[model samples]
Target: MSVELSVGKKVSVTVPGSSANLGPGFDTLGLAVGIYDTVEVEVIASGLEVEVFGEGQGELPLDGSHLVVKAIRSGLAAADVHAPGLRVVCHNNIPQSRGLGSSAAAAVAGVAAANGLAGFPLSDAQVVQLSSAFEGHPDNAGASVLGGAVVSWTEVPVDGRTEPQFKAVNIPVHSDIKALALVPSFHVSTEAVRRVLPTDITHLDARFNVSRCAVMTVALQQDPSLLWEGTRDRLHQPYRADVMPVTAEWVNRLRNRGYAAYLSGAGPTIMVLGTEDVAQSLLDEAREQGIRVLPLEVAGPVEVKVLK
Candidate 1:
């Protein structure tokens, strides 16, 4: 059954950007950061409208084609409701295609707004599931919705014919641990990056990643210092190094200097797990090299506010 949604009521949502595959936890772990993207959605009369600011002003779609609008419509439909025209204003601080989960934030914000307009028909888990499905992966979606640190994985269904569904848990992190992102000016397509990876891996490589992932999980919970050794991986990064040589270069450089560094999601953005002071120094150096970087804290969950 669908709830009766009111017109003209305003809802706003704030979502945090996420860095996925934090070290060896490929396709499984994510960290929510301080970078944010906000969307204010309101029911309107005739047609959909959108205004984009900051990151993708001229690049993003001005109509229903926008990811935010698409997510709202999808959520509303899932709840068995028809969408009236919506007026959406977005202020995006997270850089798109920088492995910062900008797309995940946009999807979550839209779903949150739609849920509010529909009298809160969806739960947080449902919203996260929808958002993850929209992004075609769970790591970024899980972190954007649940915040802090997220671990996600999929299992096959009982019927056997259907695709596996993902489940996630939000875990606590040490307060001192933070993220430093080095985002280059160039854009790297996530799809393009994935295409370069091999279809299979050796048994030794699989064992190596699993052992490191276990260490990463525990290190994030209680001892971040262990991350210097725990973040080492043999699964995805080695095979796909050529896709983003600069990103790999920096990761190797930092590892040589005894720091935990990993590719933030696919490519072109490298994430360093360290304290603010240490991360800040790297950010400064990146800026000097004409590369942009942002030091971010592990953010709390997403927030929603209703306008009076």
Candidate 2:
């Protein structure tokens, strides 16, 4: 049996943006950044309504087809609760399609909102699973749900008919670690960037990434100095350099100068993970080239509050 949420019920959810593939742990490591998106949802009497503000205000859909709305429906269904209607308002700070996990943040916010409206029926793991299913991978969604840094993986069902199970564990990030993103003006499609990767890779390259992934875990937890070596990869970044030349150039430049920089997700954004800020000259140079630089701290998990 389904329970109907009261018409006046309202909840507010704030979820942080994420940076995924944090170097060699491609599709496995993610970090939640300080940038956030906040969504307010209310159960109403009759129909669906949506309002988007800030980053994607004019371009994003204001209807049920919106990603946030879909996620809310998914969450409500999972909780066996129904809302007669919904009003969703999004105040977005995360840049859309900029490899900053804006979509993942939306999914997290919506699901979190639904859980709050339902008296918190879902567990943290359940929220991570539901949010990650929208992305087919747990990296971004997992970070937004669990916060700080996360190591995540997916389990495929043997029958291939059931949805893959998404799981993640929060890993403590060293206090000195900080993130700086050099965001390009143009948007890069994650799917398009992914399609460019080869169908297969050499075992030697795989081994290199595996070692770095391990190093990254250690570096994130205890040793910030190892960040340079930890962030090195022989897998995706090399191949992706061609399509995003400017981002490739900046990453190379920073790395050559002894900074740990890499492509952020399927990105035009080059992210630097280090204990201190990038040199001002480099930031100025990037700005002159129209790249927006954002200095961010590691963020906490998504937060939800019941307003009514």
Candidate 3:
């Protein structure tokens, strides 16, 4: 039997935004940046109520179909608990559909909120699993759940009828490393960008990406200098360039100047990971071309609090 949450019980959740692919790691690697979205969930006596502010104010749905609401219900089910009604308020700072993992962050905020309301019944791994299921891949979701950097993977059930298992392990990013995001004004659908990728690639390219993925893991932990080489890739990004010409142009521009820049997620946002800042003049030039520059530090895991 599900335990009923008390009316007036409230929980607040803060989850960070993330960047995935980080070049060669493809769907395997992700990093949580300082950008955040905060959601507050309160159990009430009657019907559901949701309020949105900041980033997704007018556009996002305010009903049960909302990703956050769905995730809350999923979390409550997993915890064997129920809320008679909920009041959810979201304060979003992450840019939507700009390769910044806004969707994953929302999912994390919802799951984390549910877990908090349930008196912390879910483990970190369970939280990761529930939140990641929303994305069909764990990279972005895992980073938001576990924070810092994460290496994640999925487990397929032998029966093929059961849901795939999502798992992630946190990685300690080198302290000196920072993230620089060059965000474009327009939104790009993750699905639309993914459709442009070819169905197959040569063994040589596969081998090349594997080596770079290995390099990236080491660079993120031990040697910041290896970042430039580690971020090199022959997969997804190349196929995506034509679709996001401005993002592609800026990525090439920053990389040519020796910064380790890559397309963030399924992007229109280009992300740079490095120990030092990119030159101001170049940043100014990107701004002149209408790109929004955000410099952020690596962030910690999602934080949740049961409110009085």
Candidate 4:
């Protein structure tokens, strides 16, 4: 019998979905949600075996090309270990391509599981680095890695290098505050949505968002009741509205109905943040509009736990 360079074993990792830019944080703020992507990694006698369930259903590939597999491979390569023959099973509960940080969850799950399978050869930092590398952004990946809520920034590393450093601030996400997600029965590419954003932002608008972002983080930390007044944005959302007219219209409706509605990432899904009563009311309106509403309780804490 031939000996393998890397001994593969089964490991599981779960990552919560995240919503970035909650309102004014714009590529800085991210909140982990109740939704998750679970990944099980096990050794196989052959090449990579990828089986996907839930969200990506018919759309995902069962090959090394998938984001999860790619993250695992990247983790292995970074640790200078040979990529092992493995079987990957993914249960994706978060909606993909709907601005719910689906790719971030998948990437985080893969790296976390790979690190476990590799006998912890890679440190947590390495895993974050690997995930961030593949994801091309740290906001989502960092939030997934750290859990809870993260506000981060990308900085050019020394020697003309580029990398991102993130800090996770534990904010008191209100228990009474619920997330009412209004998801359309359609898919929109993140690239297409990004294309609609203006390259240059006005100084006044930038200042406005900066002020609101500060207010949002502090308000969520101290008094979440201020969330409605705090979660305001002057950047990105308005510019990207052309790509998500339905979401925009619905957000306006929610706001008019006295709820705080904001774009969830590069959204086709608008998140209505409010108390239970407002959430229920928003849900009812979503039903009336034929929009499926996923009511997720405000996520509490930043840490990944194995469900099984």
TM-score of each: 0.94, 0.99, 0.99, 0.89
Each prediction's number of clashing residue pairs:
0, 0, 0, 2
Model 2 CA deviation exceeding 4 Å by range: none
Write candidate 1's Cα lDDT for 1-308 as tens digits. 65545668788889999999987888899999999998898888668879999999999999878999989887887677765678999999999898899888899888877777776878877887777777677898889889899988766679988856656789999988988788888888888888887889889999998999899988899988798878888888886688788888889988887778898898678888976355456667778877787778999888888883
**Which residue runs does candidate 1 get wrong by more than 4 Å?**
1-4, 158-164, 279-282
Over the full model, what C-alpha lDDT does candidate 3 score relative to the true structure?
Answer: 0.95
* lDDT by residue for model 4 (1-308), tens: 32244444567787888888888887788887788788887776678788999999889998979999988877766655564487889888999999888988888887887677656777655666677776566777777777667777666567765554533444556556667678887788888888888889889988998888888887666666677766788788888777788998987877776677898888888887666455466567678877778877655322333322
Question: What is the C-alpha RMSD, rounded to one decimal, of candidate 4?
Answer: 3.1
Cα distance off (Å), candidate 3, residue 250: 0.6
* RMSD (Cα, Å) of model 3: 0.6
What TM-score would candidate 1 get against the native?
A: 0.94
TM-score, predicted candidate 3 vs. hidden true structure? 0.99
Better of 2 and 4 by lDDT: 2
Which 10 consecutive residues of model 1 have the lowest summed lDDT? 275-284
> Looking at model 2, how many pairs of residues clash?
0
Q: Which ten residues in a row have the lowest lDDT in candidate 2?
A: 268-277
CA lDDT, every prediction? 0.84, 0.95, 0.95, 0.75
